[model samples]
Target: MERAAEAAREGNAQYFLNLGDDELIKLCQKRDEDGRSLLHSAVVGGNMHLVQLLVERCGNERINSQDSEGWTPLTSAVSCGFEEIVKYLLSLGADPNSTNAQNRTPLHYAASKGRVPIIKLLIEAGAKTNTKDIAGWLPLHRAASAGRAEALRELLLHTSKPLINARDISGSTPLLLAASGGHQAAAVLLAAKGADVEAEDKDGQTPLGAAAPHGQLRDALVALATGEKTLDDFEN
Candidate 1:
């Protein structure tokens, strides 16, 4: 099993080829100490050829298999911004909405990293835009919190009607999260998209109120809350 994992990490295609058909099958079925299959190792290593070989042998059932962390190979690929690997995994029938232990899908990973191409692929592959993680954070929440302005824009454009002001477990809307994270661009985008800049979190802190102390764009946030300057003004 260790050899198989090592082969995957090194992208050693001939190692599997040298083994008999049944032996290769057994190797493909093996999991590492961390409960990750050869497919997981391949994806993690960004070894596209190894990934292709493993998927060809093990099929889509293995593609959707989760590791100890509940992360599918698709999720792993997405998190690392491996665009080609993500596309290949999806082509092999990997579920775009497959979740990790935190219930964060590939879209959440892509959104967090601002991987717009990967996000588009996942959405096109039927990932629900409003899907929530264990923390009740939607992909928009992740994008906003990470200050992924382009990813946020892509998400809003893809969804039929995004919950612009949807609250998470902490009662923090996307706007509040952006403001709390000091992500001025994201905050401005959310506000322009009709997020309630005045909406409070569980602590009753408005976006402006929450951002005042630590936010780099405190003045911009203040103007946004007061409607003194609109998103269009910033865009222009």
Candidate 2:
């Protein structure tokens, strides 16, 4: 299996092709000692051609089949922000909500990377915005914590009525996460969406309090101070 993977990495398309359907099935079905498959190899290679071929031969259910790390082929594609590969996987009915060992969905990957197109694609496909990971962090929480302004915007546009003030298991709302990360744009957006800038968590830290120490949070502070209108009002 490592040899086949190395072959793919070295661009030995012919060797991969010659591995035979029977052999390919064996490898794709036979989890390595590491629990990885030939499909996993194709995904790691990010070879769109190989991925398509693997899908055509192995089918979509196998496309999501995971290795030891619980990473599906779609997970690999999204992690690298491979837009077309992700699209193809989704077209084949790949599970948008599938979580790895960390409990992160593909939306989380796109949000964390600030990949707008992929983020939009996932949202349009009905990816849940509020899915929690092992850390109880949702895609919104990740976008806020990572300061991914564009990702947050795409999400807001899609989820017009999203729980802007919904707290994670840590009791941190999107506003608090954004402010804590010093993401002015995200914080402002959250506040404008009716995030309770003054809402305190178990620790008694408001979004405003979270932003207090960060100079970059000034615009967000002002937005929170003055943004009294409901976030839903801004929806088109």
Candidate 3:
């Protein structure tokens, strides 16, 4: 099994390709202590050939199979920025909305990590933008918290105004999350897209109030909040 794992890692396609289907299935079904299948290893290792070979042999169920952490091969690909691998997996019927132990989807990881390309692939694959994780945080919240502007822009386009302003369990809206995290660009973008800058969280903290810490270009954000200026106007 270790040798097979190494073969997958090293892109030794012929080694596995030569094995009979029965032998291959037996080899692929073996999991590590964490319950991660050979498919998981292929994805994580970024070996597209091995991934294709394994998925073709192992079939759809195995391709979408989750490990103990509930992460599918698609999840691993998204996390690792393996765009081509992610595309191939989705094309082969891998679930785009697969969640992990935290109930976070591949979209959540793509948004949080600023994977603009991956974000496109996931959303086009029909990944839901509003799906909340254990913390009641959506992909928007994750993108804002991470200060991912381009990814945030893509999300803003597809999300409705209300969901753009939607609050998480801790009462942090995307704007508040962006501001508090010192993401000036993201906060402005959220505000321009109809997020209420004055909307308070459960703790009565608004985006402006939360942004008090970073103190970056305060006037610009304040002007944006009050409708005196829009982020788009600034660029124009």
Candidate 4:
């Protein structure tokens, strides 16, 4: 098992290159103490050849198999920001909505890392943009809080207006998260996308209130909130 993991992780195909079919099956069946299979390590290693070899030679059941952390190959690829691997997995029927231990999907990870192209691929592959994690944070919330403006825009392209104003379990909207995180660009983008700036969190703080510590951000949100200015004003 260790040897298999090592080969998969280091992109060393020699370990499995000449192995017999039965040997390959036994190796693929074994998991590390962490419950990660060779496929998991192969995805983490970013070796497309190994991935193809395993999935094609073995079977598809392991494609969505979760380790102890509940991560599938699709989830791992998205986490590592490997577009080609993600695309390959999706093309081979990997679930776009696969979730990990935190109930966070591939879209959630892509949004947080600001993987714009990956974000588009995941959404196009049928990833749900509004699915919440364990914290009730949606992909939109993740992008906004992480200040991923382009990723957020990609998500917005598939979101409904009601979802645009959706709040998390903490009652924080994407705009509120952006403002609290001092992401002026994200805050502006959210507002322009129809986010309710007047929306409040559990603390009774609106987006403008959340941006109070950042003078420029606060003023920008305030102007947009009151219709005194538009994002176009700044962009123009």
Candidate 5:
């Protein structure tokens, strides 16, 4: 099974072709010690061709198959920023909202990596914008916490009703997370999109208040919150 997985990772299509169709089916169904299928290995390898080949032989049922960490091929692809592989997997009936053991979806991974295209793609593929992970964080929260302004923008735009001020397990909104992380541009974007600057976390730390001691752009965040500055002002 490890050899087959390695072959898939190496994009050695001939390896599978050499095996009879029945043998290939068994190989595809086999799992490694970690419970990862050939599809998972193919995705981790960033080989879209191998992924397609495996899916074609194993059927789409394996597209959403989860490994030990509960990461599916789609999540793995999104995490690695393989936009083409992600799209192909989704088209092959991969569930965009499929959760791992931590309840983290592909959207969460994409947002964290700042993969704007993958974020947009997953959202369009029916990924729930408000889906929370084990940490009670939505994809928006992940984007903000990662300081991914472009990814946050794409998420907000695609979401029908974005929970701009939604709280995570830490009681922190996207704005609060962005501010605490010193993501000035992300904070500005959240503010422009109706995020509440005065919203507090479990520690009663408002966005600007949370940013004051740690972030270099605390003043700019305050100005943006108070309408003293616009997002365009930061572009200059």
Candidate 6:
């Protein structure tokens, strides 16, 4: 196990790869002060070949395995913008819905980064649109809050109705997050899906109040304020 770690540090790729799966498995199990797998190091090093070798040999049962930080291989790929690796992990049946320590799924990461292709692929491959993270913010809220217009639009196609006004831990709805982030297009979509323009957060801030500071978002806020949609329409 120590040898593998040394090999990794010394950049001895062949020595590390030549180690048997049983030996590698033991090393993979070994954790740093903060837990991270050989897979984590492999991915972090951008060694796609090594990642594939590890996946094929060690097995794909825990393809989405997390380190001490609760980040999966898929999450890491999304964070690093490794689109090819992301697709390969999904093909290996990685659980898209699995959250890390932060309770954020791959969809949230993809949406937050505006990785439109990754977002589309994840949704098509069965990622849930409305799953909440640690913050209780849905994928929609993350996308809208990050101003990921295309990702939000792509996500909408999968669900006819995805709790548009679902509140997070802070009692801020998707509309509120989008408005606060000055995401005009996202605010409009949330409104069309029946988000309450008048909904308030713990601080008594409505979506309009959140968006008032942004010139582009103000128009969307005004439109939603005038629309007939109400929170009652979305009540479960």
Compose the digit string of candidate 6's lDDT tens values, residues 1-236: 55555555444578766787688777766655556666666666566777787777777766777878798878888777778888888899888888888888888889888888888778878898877888898877888889887777777677557377788888898888888887777777777667787899888999888877987566655655676444243332
The residue pairs in collision within model 1 are: none
Sort every candidate by lDDT, greatest first: 4, 3, 5, 1, 2, 6
C-alpha lDDT of residue 195 in model 6: 76
Strongest candidate by lDDT: 4
lDDT by residue for model 1 (50-145), tens: 788776776657888888999888999999899999999898789998888998989998999999999999999999988899888999999999
Error of 2 at 120 (Å): 1.9
Error of 2 at 211 (Å): 1.1
**lDDT of model 4 at position 187:** 90
What order do candidates take by TM-score, descending?
4, 5, 3, 1, 2, 6
lDDT of 2 by residue, 1-236 (tens): 77877765554567767777888767667666667777666666777888777667666668678878888877888888779888888888878989999999999889888999998777777787777888877787888889887788888776646577777877888889989888877787777766778878889888888888886475446645685443454343
Root mean square deviation (Cα) for candidate 3:
1.7
In order, the Cα lDDT scores of the candidates are: 0.86, 0.77, 0.86, 0.88, 0.86, 0.76
The best candidate in terms of TM-score: 4
Clashing pairs in 4: none
Better of 3 and 5 by TM-score: 5
lDDT of 4 by residue, 160-208 (tens): 8788878888899999999999998899988876788788888898987
Better of 1 and 3 by TM-score: 3
lDDT for residue 161 in candidate 4, whole number 0-100: 76
TM-score for each predicted model, relative to the true structure: 0.92, 0.88, 0.93, 0.96, 0.94, 0.81
* Regions of candidate 3 where Cα sits further than 4 Å from its true position: none
lDDT of 4 at 21: 86
- The window of 10 residues in a row where model 3 has the poorest summed lDDT is 212-221
Pairs that collide in candidate 6 are: none
